[model samples]
Target: MLKKVISKTIQLPDNRVITIETGKLATQANGSVLIRMGNTMLLAAVVAKEAPEEGGFSFLPLSVDYQEKFAASGKIPGGFLKREGRLGDHEVLIARLVDRAIRPLFPKRFNSEIQINISLISADETILPDALAALAASSALSVSSIPFNGPISEVRVARVNGTFLINPSPSLLEQADINLIVAASDSSILMVEGAMSEVGEADMIAAIRYAHDAIKLQCQVQKELMEAVGVEKTIGTTHHASAIVCYPIALREAIYADLYAVAKQHIPSKALRKEAFMAVSNRYREQLAKDQNGQEVTTTQQKEWLDELENQAIRALILNENVRLDGRLLDQIRPIESEIDYLPSAHGSALFTRGETQSLTTVTLGSKFDEQIIDRAMEDGYNRFMLHYNFPGFSTGEVKPNRGPSRREIGHGNLAMRALKAVLPPDKENLYTIRVVSDILESNGSSSMATVCAGSLALMDAGILVKAAVSGIAMGMITDPTTGRFAVLSDILGDEDRIGDMDFKVTGTYQGITACQMDMKVAGISYAMLEKALHQAKEGRLHILEKMAETIAAPRLDSKPHAPKIVTIEVEKEMIGAIIGPGGKVIQEIQKETFTNIDIAEQGYKGIVTIFAGNQEMLEKAVSRIKTITARPVMGEIYKGKVKSVLNYGAFVEFMPGKDGFLHVSEVRLERIENLEDVLEVGEELQVKLIGIEPKTGKYRLSRKVLLAPDVVAAGG
Candidate 1:
């Protein structure tokens, strides 16, 4: 078959062009598309099983994989296998971005195990593939025969020097104060995840709007591409894959009053509230059994009916009577308790509990050797600030094996890391490699936000000197599809998150937002609603911040007494080799003698030397030794030196830590010395003067005769 490729080009605000083409790759799949921007190319292919998997599923079984091949960047894999293993954190994050963008666009009952795979086939050093992955995924779905409500697109908008640029280059993005990845359809935003430099709400909104405009253009291109390909989405008949059982109005009416009363009770205990709801469900089940003359009812069907009833009852209580599960106002936050220095052995630790959710966070400081090495197809560097989140099954009162960090765990840790990174001291001032680990001890809802609060407090407790304290809150929205009425909830409960239309989390300092993540379940949510959510989240965040401040308002003036001390010094690049010496013998001797750790890195013409020591005395010793090594030699200056080795003709003396000078037998003493070893012991220390330096060999010449008395020298000769 002839491959007829159709292409559409989009000109960016910076005048760069991106092209989207179909029919050139993976045509046998349900849908496929290849998108190119600069030298980077991404291929997205989507396929769906004709029918739902056996045993059936009520929700969409969508799986998204975003992979970056090492070959794409003209490099090979690093590990022994020489093949890509499981996705790295960076790759997982991009896949999550694409998943969050297009997950809501599919039909609600489309449970056909749909899989979207995107590959970075070719890469450019400057262009990031995150937003393009989403766009290509959406375009592939648009050209497929499957039913979808989207031709959505995503753009990474950054504000550099007070101007917003759409999908800026990597270098340009580094300079941006406000960086966001926004996913949107032609009309409304579907997902948002990014970090900023404590940017205000208004500025964030402006960035999102700016990105939406660019997203609109990309979405339009997908539409035109679909039309050109003559592929119209097949409006298949809606099939209830699980054979959903809808209860009668009489049954719902029977349970409505009781369910509403239970929901209105405002039970603060999650376990109690859950039990009460279950009691109500059991009553409904018994009534249904009697109504059907005691016929056996499928457990799944009965549970589904009861779930729907509960959703309706809780939503109505909130929307009609302004009553929440916990009796808090729509903008009210849960009670927060925070404490710092909770662990004696840890460098820094904090216990943050907000309502039922809690995070025990700890901070550790190390030298540059502790920094994490990131080696990927497109990006290679060291990450000094790391945050690891762990959610044990016991935290949620469940029994499950611990297999390691899940995708959700990684995503949550990343969001918290971004939030706290904004307040960390600049690289120059903060020299230690920092790691923040949050362990969930209890979870009800918004545990990631709790991690943020605890991590901030722990950092302060560790004397990190953060620019400002950061706090986070989760916001939920419940919308009346028919009436267009919506309620924005602050610090929502787990149930609200499952039943709500949106799960929006905002994190920031007192001045502005630092990081945020939003996922929308419903379509066409107006900007007004989002604005309201942001404002409400801000209030909640401030409340949490006030509570956190009660524990520790600012970073501690000094780190713990047991913590390691770091000192940095800069010297000329020429001095680096002198300090390291041949085969690293000099520096190794210094570290072994001083009992300290040292690292050296070159920047331009200067070398940055960092020393980590146990105490001030050790730090001083290391610093002084490095100074002596890099110190320049002066002519005609007498200095105390140690004899490193002895030879027949002469002996080499170490004038400095790594600087050695040749001392001849004639210069050893005023008298004639026959045996150099006997005259000058190998490990002896003596006074020597810098007489001259041989320019040809760049060797220093020292004289002991110059320091001897004039009469005594002549008599000895």
Candidate 2:
């Protein structure tokens, strides 16, 4: 009844197996596949519709959405909605990985609207499915009767204690130094995204190669299943170019010559070079309407092909002449100029300008009240460190209305955040909520990497003792599909990145790579070429780090004058009730009297106390009050205790906070007292020593006679 449940399984190098099955569910879609690994299961269903009825878009209309079902994790959804509403940042990010991997494999002219939806139907706590979501989505599209050039799969490569592990469990990831998610076709890597612990270039590259081996085998499994299913993949007829795209023979020839000439020309200013290239494109567009046939109804996409030709022209020059668009050596980085404390009022600020790209970054430190609250699927908590990146249209000389941050902005910001997070001072060492904002004032290429560089400086300027200065570089690669000759370009430009086959962003410090992202458009690149790129990236990264050092060598000795100061103390857990009285009255009163923030938490047998204030006076005031509340009564300690009440035989003395002791009438004086009223009265003061405690009752014994001179007690008797 279920079509026998066709399935194929591949054993991972780590001894874990992934089973992909079809024909049991969602058969109406163009393609559907269920991927299982260690009890984790994800369902990917892809459907395509013919071109939109009245389309405003000419390019491929593709959408990828990923959702995590709480039911799959054996948990009920939280919040008032009692169900998942919008996609969280993590889900959106996962969807982006899949979109980037498969978007390029589709035929350029396949304008049919396509949608891929992936859901985690069964979530295994031990096995993370975010990395596997991409693989499942691609497998679905691969086995379907769709003209996709992929049965690609992605693998998570983690280096734990110097050994590479594929698809490591959550617990094993705790020890990994290098982590990467690599998506690949049979022979070529399609997409790459990962973070590292500043491992060397060689290690990072080796990790990639290791990941591809697993990916290749998975691809083979999908191919076999596709063959066994015997589904005929669709083969769309090759669409011809429109008349407008078919530029005149004379004009096309002239444009090619012009582009080659332009690429060879030595232009230092990015704006001037961009103008030179656009001038040729404008001239060709002007000639398109000169024909009497009236092809003014040309789709925007057709005219865009002319731009593609320009890209090709640039690529040809890069491959043939080993010449970059900027006229720098293949390994040369653009000149970098950086300065700290650029903003007068910012807690910490820096402006980093690398050739054409610029970032004005600022850092702000606050108390726990400023921490960001997370309300997401997997976890809901607070974040003490946050980084935000912004790119305005005017930054790149574009004219468009500003709305909100695009997906690219969010993704880049997240990358930079992780790059610097590894080096931040631990919360216990310095407790302050941190926020870094990078505003792109000018951009040509690698603004995100520029953000990383600027963020490090800003943090140092704010006196944050980061482990080491962090720097980033974006590497570009141009390959000749014919002879397989490839050139890895360092510090690439906008034009080079547009034409290049790969944009590999590598970021870190002198130690190793902190983060990396690689996305390739070609079928595949060889290990030799990839290795060269990594080494070159390292050279560029080190060069940038040296430049950053010239601006700020290390964190300053002090925060700015206006920054808030934090003080912390620990106390016995039993004393917590005294600090936070009934109805939180004591803590509230302390805050009011000192104008400071007090946060308390119980950790096992001890309680953590944190005091945040803007001035020395307030900070000291809060610390003293909390100390008094948590201090314990010590033996033989003299206290000017007040007589709380007088009794027939003794007086009650109020001592250390929340502690009281009995001062016996006989002990009140050296000579025996005839009446208690004659020696002591309520609301009186006396210097007493805590000499002993009743073993059974736990009542402290106070002595005032021990402090009296011996002659005075003898004369009184």
Candidate 3:
């Protein structure tokens, strides 16, 4: 039987088109779609369990995995395994992007385990596949029988030379000052995440709006393709429960007043506030049991009602009374305190605390050899700057086991890295490989933002010449659905984030936003609210930066005493071999003598040499040796020379590091010398002057009698 292949096309700005085809591959999957543009193709296959996991999950069990096949780019995987083992950070980030966009579109009561796997089967150098992952995943859902409220798609918007390009080529993306990946349904934006070069609030919103326009077109294409495939939304076929779980209205009425009172208490301690709320909830549970006259109340039922009550009370208090759980007004930030050099032995360290969240961050500098090798399917490069975020369970006052970095940690660290990477000095000026690690010692909310603040401070303290200090703030929103009254909270707490409608984080210098990420739990967020959040987040960020400035305003004059010092020099391309000598012998000797590390790369007509040493003295020694090796031999220039060999006719002396010259027997002394070894033994050091070069051999000539006194010459004659 012939397969029924269906495809749809989306025409974008600049006449670029993306095609989505179904029924061609992965036929065993519940739904599968292949999305392609400019020779780049991503195959997204989604599978959903008909029933929930054994116990029935309280939350949506959705997982998204994005992988890139080395065969996609016609390259072999690195490492001894010679195959992809685990998902790299980059792949995890892309999976997260897709997951965030489609997660909210699923029904709240549907707890089925859904897995979306997107693979890059074909790679295009100019066109990146990350921006297409979400589109493919959503398209797969659209064609499936799964109950989804989405035909959403994502697009990349980049502003280069004042023009906004949709899903631009990689080269264009590099020159973009405003880069954003926006996910949206046909009507509303769902997710926004990307980095910028200090772009303003208005421009950021405009970019999102611009991206949504393209997304609308792509979403429409998915809808058309789904219709063409004739897949009906059969909710009952899958274990999708459409019923809205309703709690006892009487229970809510009885507990809401007390919960609101507890919320209004302005309890500063997280633990205390939690206890107070729990007391009211438990009291209500007892009252309900008494009202029912011994009706059994399961913990799940009690929790469900209590959660509903707390959500109502906190949101009501904020909307009606204009106060938060901690009694701060809307748009108000929590207290901030920061310190630098907190760890005595670290190259650089800082402790940044905002309210209950704290990040103890440290900076480590290393040589080029320390750079992280990125061997991916589409690209092979080195990451000189890395930020690792560690969130131990103790940070949140829990007893969780340490199981390496989770997806959340990697995502947080990547955001912080992007936030500060824009402010780093050029590679030529800063040669050391930099790694910033953030350990969350205490966390209530926005620990990732604290990492940004602390990482900036630590980088500066480590004598890294950062262009500007960066800070971050997590903004939240609470909306009254009945009245459409919304409040944008700055520097939100853990409770606010849990109950809030939006978690929007912005990071940047004082000027504008450098990086931003927004995830909405609500159906959608208005652009006006987004703009308000951006500006509010900016105010909070600026305030936090003020606290940071009080600790360390700028980079130190130099790195710490124990930190390695790096110096770079350039030489003629032809001299690169001479510096390395026969199989790196010369470079190795120089390093051994000066206690330094050296690396050289040939670029264009020059060779770049980087030297890493323990101190200024050792650095100077290595630099001098490299200079001598690369320096050109000049006539009439005197130099300290080492005799490499003593022959009967002449002594072969190294006038410069790699340049050898012949010193005639007569040139060694004012009088005739029968044996050159008598005056100049092998490995002897002497002073000589470069005289001339042999016409055909390009050999150098050296002389020693040119500086002799006239009286001494007359006496010898």
Best candidate (score: TM-score): 3
Q: Which ten residues in a row have the lowest lDDT in candidate 3?
A: 236-245
Give me the runs in candidate 2 sitting further than 4 Å from their true place.
1-4, 52-58, 235-244, 282-286, 290-302, 367-376, 380-382, 399-404, 666-686, 704-717
Off by over 4 Å in 1: 232-248, 290-296, 614-617, 632-638, 643-682, 688-717
Q: Give the Cα-based TM-score of candidate 1 against the true structure.
A: 0.92
| Per-model CA lDDT versus the true structure | 0.90, 0.84, 0.89
Pick the winner on TM-score between candidates 1 and 3: 3
Backbone clashes for every candidate come to 0, 3, 0
lDDT of 1 by residue, 1-717 (tens): 799999999888889999999998999999999999999999999998876667668678889999999999999988799999999998889999999888888886676788999999999988988879999999999999888889899999999999999988899999999999999999999999999999999999999999999999998888889899999666353455224444566777879888889999999989999999999887766665432444455676667667777899899999998879989888888888889999988889999999999999999989888999988999888999999999999998899799989989999999999999999999999999999999999999999999999999999999999999999999999999799899999999998998899999999999999999999988756799989999989999998899888889889998898788898999999999988889998889889989999999999999999999877789899999999888889998878999999999899998766678999999877789888878887789988889889989989998887778687567762
lDDT of 1 at 108: 68
In model 3, how large is the Cα lDDT of residue 539?
87
Using lDDT as the measure, which candidate wins? 1
Candidate 3: the clashing residue pairs are none
The candidates, ranked best first by TM-score, are 3, 1, 2
lDDT string for model 3 (1-717, tens) is: 788999999899999889999999997888999999989999999988877767577678899999999999999999899998899999999999998888989876777788999999999998999999999999999999788999999999999999999999989999999989999898888889999999899999989999998998898889889889998866442232213334466765768888989999999899999999989876766555432444555566567656876898899888888889998888788888999988988889999988899999999999998999989999899989999999999998899998889999999999999999999999988998999999999999999999999999999999999989999999999987788899999989999999999999999998888999989887778888888888888888898888889999999989999888998898999999999999889999999999998999988989999999988889999999998788888889888899999889898998887889998887877788887777778888888889999889999999887756477467752
Could you tell which candidate, 1 or 2, scores higher by TM-score? Answer: 1
* TM-score of every prediction relative to native: 0.92, 0.91, 0.95
Clashing pairs in 2: 188-524, 198-512, 198-513
